[model samples]
Target: MNLFMSFLLLFLLYTDKLAGLNFNTDVTVTWGQSHVAKSRNGEEMEFKMDQYSGASAQTNADFLFGRFDMRVKLNSPDSTGTITTFYLHSPNRDLWWDEADFEFIGGSSTADYKIHTNLITDGIGNREQQFRFPFDPASNYHTYSFFWTPQQIIWYVDGIPIRVYRKLSDSRILYPDKQPMKVYTSLWNSTAWTGEVNWKNAPFSAHYRNFYVNACVAWRDGSNVSSNCKIVPPFWFTYKLLPLERDMIIRMREQYMTYDYCNDKEKVTDVTSIECANNP
Candidate 1:
């Protein structure tokens, strides 16, 4: 870890910033309630799965726009076929689907841990980017958060910026700025993506703690705000990057970023993504 990251983790550990919280009532189980189990240490809500079934859950309500943070520790021993996800999904999927994803792809060892991030708009979810962290994700707990606003979407891990996605100039490209979404986390079998659902070993568990949401009544355009929404400052939500934030983005892309769909020439041979061209 870098100097800044080390200090941040130390501070969090000592200052109750990363103190584990019980989520017995904080969330709602959307599916596989029988598989929902708490951790042995009582620190977090554990989503356990076996060969027979999988588990998934989500927050109670849909949020307009907010900063959602989740501190999680991935499965450690024999984590193969355990696909852990923390993401936001749009309610209006039939009309148009908009979503944000953080998929921890299953691998043989800790060295193979890849964090897959994506944004789906208008049911087109090609905006995919995968990354590798310097530290072993299974070794310790880390906070992953997303800052969503009318301007852009920013992904952060351990308080450091990893990716920033902004709106494109083209009207055809649908951005995730207009719809409401609900937070969801799931532990399931993703054999098509995560190799095979290795169930012979059975019993895969994922831990989650400290789910926080700082909300706002944001909209893409200058439009009607919600009734209970309070007036907010302009600087409250913007993609204005700090010095360290900019540095982290560069560092992640240069050192750890593995796959970016926009940059793949073969994928976008004839039709380049407007979001990629404009952002770059």
Candidate 2:
């Protein structure tokens, strides 16, 4: 195929695979509704944060396992002390609560931001990994995504796999397979994690568009729930990374990764975790 035809074919296939979600029907503004705005007939949404409050939205239904994607442009210049996030979180906040996060920590300049990723299982979370963006994330929208299944979780930036967490042969390591989670997006201030805010640069904003989800929806409590809803699995349930994709992940980590909890000897004295083991 010609270059133009090949590009067009790929675009068409991707759109067919993951259709865009409608904001009005698929999600609800959980907090700071006044600061949230929708455009492009509700296909695009923006979250604004200030000294007083921030904005947040969450998916209306719970999903067991899936691939979730969002195009995001973070808070711009002088956004210190702010955080923009897209994550999946369990509604139950009990001892076994689980979460997966993609947090953008704002810095003094648009190009200075960092991507912080973490996975929490059974209410314990120390597996923090951070990476520096290759370009200014706030300058344009980029697709950030994660694929979750029974065996592994993979994080992506602009469709490039950046990180992977797999369930090892050892069964002792806790995985987030049991709980159903809801997708969420938020823009908030967090001086503890980012940095002390210059209140002069208040009213930060983050834009999110082209939300997509391809996953198994959990069955709600009802009189006529179907058995198929709880049994059948999707193709992604057994997905594994190709050799080329694995090589790309290694290259991306080598070049852009800033911090990894497993490699921190001071903070993580126990090297028993699979991620800490050689060749893991």
Candidate 3:
């Protein structure tokens, strides 16, 4: 009986330790300002911005599929528009690049959340969608989170699941399924979309406080241990979604890329650069 009880005690202790490790509070802040380190954090990096320029911060963990969480509080006076972002980038140009992001934009007591995806070959294939989230993000600190896996992408507002994208794919395989992306956050002015809000009334200063970030990779196959980046998790293999294979996803990405860079918003039914227009 004593032996059995001892094993039980050990099991309980291990469980507690594992639970603690799963939700670590390690924060790495990267400021948009040039002075900040690329993957380190300190008191000076706490979120604060003014009219002169915008301030932003990002974390270093880069993974293809994982959970990302952060708590943010916006300053009331600067509520004209605030943008909190989570994004990933391509370090090298040789490999086709893939990126996904969650954006909290507009400087109001209320905020709008957006999700964007980009697949890069010659240029970029892009898609974006938006939704509303509760929490007067300017008043109090609230947790904003995302869960990305091979099959779906989910978002949370203050711990409540607000959005889920299970069908945002246009292909069944090769959708940049295996790629690494770092975590990023920033507070910026919403000049692009906040025309409805009264910017003049907003104080020049906006703040993001109690900023926190946590990341974990559910699985990995061939990965190296790097300080600022992580290898793509193995689970992404399940997605089997290749943007190039799907006609619609590829078309959508091409349209957006043309519009974003070439300013070609209209679909050119039969025009120039046929290869550039339809070849992914």
Top-scoring candidate (TM-score):
2
Q: Please give the lDDT score for candidate 2.
A: 0.82
Q: How far is candidate 1 from the true structure (C-alpha RMSD, Å)?
A: 4.9
Off by over 4 Å in 1: 1-22, 39-43, 217-227, 230-235, 269-272
Shift in Å, residue 102, candidate 2: 0.1
TM-score of each: 0.83, 0.89, 0.53
Residue 261 shift from truth in candidate 3, angstroms: 19
**What tens digits encode model 1's per-residue C-alpha lDDT throughout 168-210?**
6667756786677878999998877678766666788778887
How far is 252's C-alpha from truth in model 1 (Å)?
A: 0.4
- Estimate, for each residue in 1-280, the C-alpha lDDT of model 2 and write its tens digit: 6644554564456446785688888889999999999985779999888888999999988888878999999877899999999999987778878999999999999768899999998898888889999888998999999888888888989987888887776666668887788999999889987789887877889999999977777754652322223666655578666555677778988999999888777657543356556322
Best by lDDT: 2
Which regions of candidate 2 fall more than 4 Å away from where they truly are?
A: 1-15, 220-229, 269-272, 278-280
How many residue pairs clash in each candidate at the backbone level? 0, 0, 17
CA RMSD per model (angstroms): 4.9, 3.8, 11.3
Q: What is candidate 3's lDDT per residue for 192-251, written digit by digit as tens?
A: 665444556543333333333333432334564332224543332244223322433344
C-alpha lDDT of all candidate models, in order: 0.74, 0.82, 0.44
Least lDDT summed over 10 consecutive residues: which range in candidate 2? 220-229
lDDT of predicted model 3? 0.44
Q: For candidate 1, what is the TM-score?
A: 0.83
